[model samples]
Target: MITEDQLTSQEAIALEEKHGAHNYHPLPVVLSRGEGVFVWDVEGKKYYDFLSAYSAVNQGHCHPAIVDAMNKQAQTLTLTSRAFHNDILGRYEAFATDYFKFDKLLPMNTGAEAVETAIKIARKWAYEKKGVKEQDAQIIVCENNFHGRTTTIISFSNDEGARKNFGPYTPGFIKIPYDDPKALERALIENKNVAGFLVEPIQGEAGVYTPSDDFMKQAKAICEKHNVLFIADEIQTGIARTGALLAVCGNCTCEGHCERQETYSRPDILILGKALSGGAYPVSAVLADDEIMNVIQPGQHGSTFGGNPVAGAVAMAALNVVKDENLAQNARKLGELFRAKLNEYIKDSTIVNLVRGRGLLNAIVINDTEDSSTAWDICVALKENGLLAKPTHGNIIRFAPPLVMNEEQLLDCVAIITKTLGDFEK
Candidate 1:
């Protein structure tokens, strides 16, 4: 019966260990508060948040504008299940569709749900519009992609850890090597039943494996030639996390005004989550033009809280912050500075191999074997030194701070990161 305020960090950890599901292996720090680019441990020590909740808080923690919108909507009207009409859904739908230059959007609660919705849409479009036989339509996915842990998503995932005991898996998916346009082209040409090609513009979960600049553009071209839907899962890499509004925008620095860039690759179906609500609420969406989105009718796919009033209000405010503050531009500028600073330090370093990523979403590979605990130990040291980041794929440490972080804060974080890595150097 101990109150939350009275519990120590160890006590809180112990409580979660006993009561919570043992799915996530979190860092030992027990955080109690956050603001902007920083979070505080229960003991009151402050640390820079480099992970940004897997790029969810790209606008930063407790972003005032997003939080204000969520709070106001929560006080006024929270949820009016899809069974009935709400006051804010239509306005949000219109605003979002225009913002992203899509003809329509289907709201959902989480990244996995949005991905599933997009899959369903693609399949339906194939059956009804593309003349593919029902249930015979196949979606193409890339290796090392991490869309989500949902049953349908994991069915196509090559990550044995996620798929190990979770079968009989969902079929109708073909896996191809990532970043290889030739492989993609071959897959599409070899399979006429392919309905869509689902890919992460930059593979964020597989240690921020950013592809070549023209990869997305080429993939979209190939999909277009084959009449396949090019679905971009920007759950972790979108919303200015990769310097652009969406990773599929390539190197365009037009911020959120994608119309100014002709080189950007527009996906047939774009799945977005994480930063969509600026971490204030769970709001994910699947956006496509009417030709592709019209496949689904009422009761075909939806969540009770999918397009709730609070989600609509919070998403609009969150998106407004991205454009008004020029977060995409900031991420682009800071990301260059971060990689430059790290590269300078890495020239003489032995324990660090290389840094790869776009914009604020970057990762450094430890020079040790993947099975080595070197990266994890370095992260533990980083925590003690007042910065927070996590290791991915064992030896790769992913660093994604909020886009709102200032140059001064980023330089300070870089210093901490280099100093921490220096300790583990051979």
Candidate 2:
């Protein structure tokens, strides 16, 4: 039994090792508090939080507005288990539907659950509306997808670590290489029973694999050509993380979903999570127009805490903060500066091969191979230099700070990052 007084980072880690599930590999820092763009370790050491908890805290850690909304709602009604009507759920639903420009929204509490919800919706729509034979409908997903760790979601994943022992895997999914529109075209054309083509506008967990510039537009076109539902999993890349309202928002800055923007590739179905609640609470949502969404009848789908009052209030305030603060515009301008700065150093560095990403969601490829520890070692050095980032795969370190960050803090972080990488020069 551990005592409550002055537990060191080491002690906290030890306690976690003793009792917590060993499912995640995390950095050694033990953070106790956080605010915009920075977190304080238990020892009161401050560091730039570059990961933003995998882009979930894009509004910044412990954002005042989100916290206030959550606190205020907690005092009223927390949950009614969907058995009774709550005053806040309708207002939230209307707000979210207008924000995303969808006729309906299906709310869940996590990215994974939202993804599962999308899959079920698409399949049901296929059978009931698209005229595909029951149980024969297949969804086409990109390779290296990190939607969620649910059994059904992982069934389509080729990630051995996430897939190895978790089978007999669920079926009805067809996999294709990401960023290849021709392959997607061929797959859709060849398969008559395809229900949907699910993809990440920017594949986040898979080393931030950004597809070709025309990939989204072309994929949406192909899906339209064949009547396949275009499902975009923006769980990691959405909510201004990629410099736009969504990575699929393309060149639009119209303060809305950008359905009018010709450059935007509006998917038939959209899945969102992460920053939806500004990391204050769990809130995920799937959106579609009436023709597609109305297929799910009353008894077909539901969740206990999915559309609760607290989640409702938290998500509304969180989204309002995104627009009111102009985080999307901030991410776009700073993303350009960040990449340009890193590229300048990368030109002369032997430890880094390249840097690629949109908005603040960027990554640097280490000179070492995927199995090398060079990226891990460099991250440790970064922690010592008063910043925190993590590797996605083995050799790629993702640097996604909260969108609330400004120019000066970003440059300071860049200096810390470049200086740290300089130590690993070969």
Candidate 3:
């Protein structure tokens, strides 16, 4: 074993800086190991992981069951490249489809790839099934949505930073106001070539901005009436992260009562990623019924690593963790506790404006300009206090710890957050 003094956090960070690309602006701490809701740096300093790797660690980091499955599959078979049948892929497809209540599953490698696949399917369905003219099919998307980073995906993005140099973007996408059902209806009614409405159930990357109550259901209804597909991007909020197996499963109502009622909101096309492999492997998938998914005739859509044995096994175990441990209920319970505690702190503090989220996928709005450093400064202090979290947009900090975190651990974090925020003087 490496000695603590010899393997310091700073030394590890320096090594990364020397060799790795500067794509992410991570905290100055270097993570070496993780389990449950906690992670340790190379120097053996432990900290509560509040961001959950952008909610990808919902099943906790390096879950033993998921890891074991990956190891077993690795020793047996890793990839068959979808050329020949793999033992685990079909089983995983059935398992995932049944779990999400979909008829078919299109496995992919990353969240972006899943999003891209859904777009292709929606367009093809529009043309083949809905009789929309080729090259004229249009899909409706929300403003400020973080679908992915591909050229086509970024084309419709409202953020200049994401689109500045990437332009001449792919067309055929219609932009609409988020959280407004009326806007969606108007667009669908006005556009004869409307194909589908693609949106995030809860926009995680856009500072965890959840929409109005009845937004999703109403959107689904409109899509049905207009013969349009309602595609949900649940990459960040799916798999029990939002307290109910899926964020769309719970009522979109802002009222607290909806959490009690077991409502299963279904989307025509469901995209999932991030925690699909319990942070053990890169796995993503899009689930849909047969009619819609059948639009793609093989060779049009496939990935070399989409349904490999390793991915299949890891995904199964990761999903089992969610179902077996009742992570949905745990997240729901902890979310309530978290929001209640944060609301109490929000009463008088000028630094924190408000807290809003469905389950553990929540964010706190800092009362400052969009470019303000208050959120970043607070995060630095939180790191000093032994909790690791980061700001999303300039002034918003998302707090999503792993679902395996217990009440005692959560309270300790709450205390740390309250103290850290309390010390910041306006």
Compared with the true structure, all predictions reach lDDT values of: 0.93, 0.92, 0.88
Identify the candidate with maximal lDDT.
1
In Å, residue 34's CA in model 3 sits off its true spot by 0.6
Q: Residue pairs in steric clash, candidate 1?
A: none
Q: Per-residue alpha-carbon lDDT of model 3 for 213-249, expressed as tens digits?
A: 6788788889999999999999989888888777777
Q: After superposition, how far is residue 154 of candidate 1 from its true place, in Å?
A: 0.8
Residues 1-426 of candidate 1: C-alpha lDDT, one tens digit per residue: 235666788998999999999999999999989999999987888999999999999999999999999999999999989999999999999999988889999999999999999999999999999999998999999999899999999999999999999999999999999999999999988999999999999898899998988999899999999999999999988888888888888777674446557669999999999999999899999999999998899878889899999999999999999999999999999999999999999999999989988899999999999889999999999999999999999999999999999999999999999999888887
Candidate number with the higher TM-score (1 or 3): 1
Those runs of model 1 whose alpha carbons end farther than 4 Å from true positions after fitting are 1-4, 255-260
Q: Tell me how far the alpha carbon of residue 186 in candidate 3 is from the true structure, in angstroms, after superposition.
A: 0.6
Model 2, range 159-212, lDDT digits (tens) per residue? 898999889999899999999999998898889999999999888888887888
The residue pairs found clashing in candidate 2 are none
**Model 2, 78: alpha-carbon shift in Å?**
0.3
lDDT of 3: 0.88
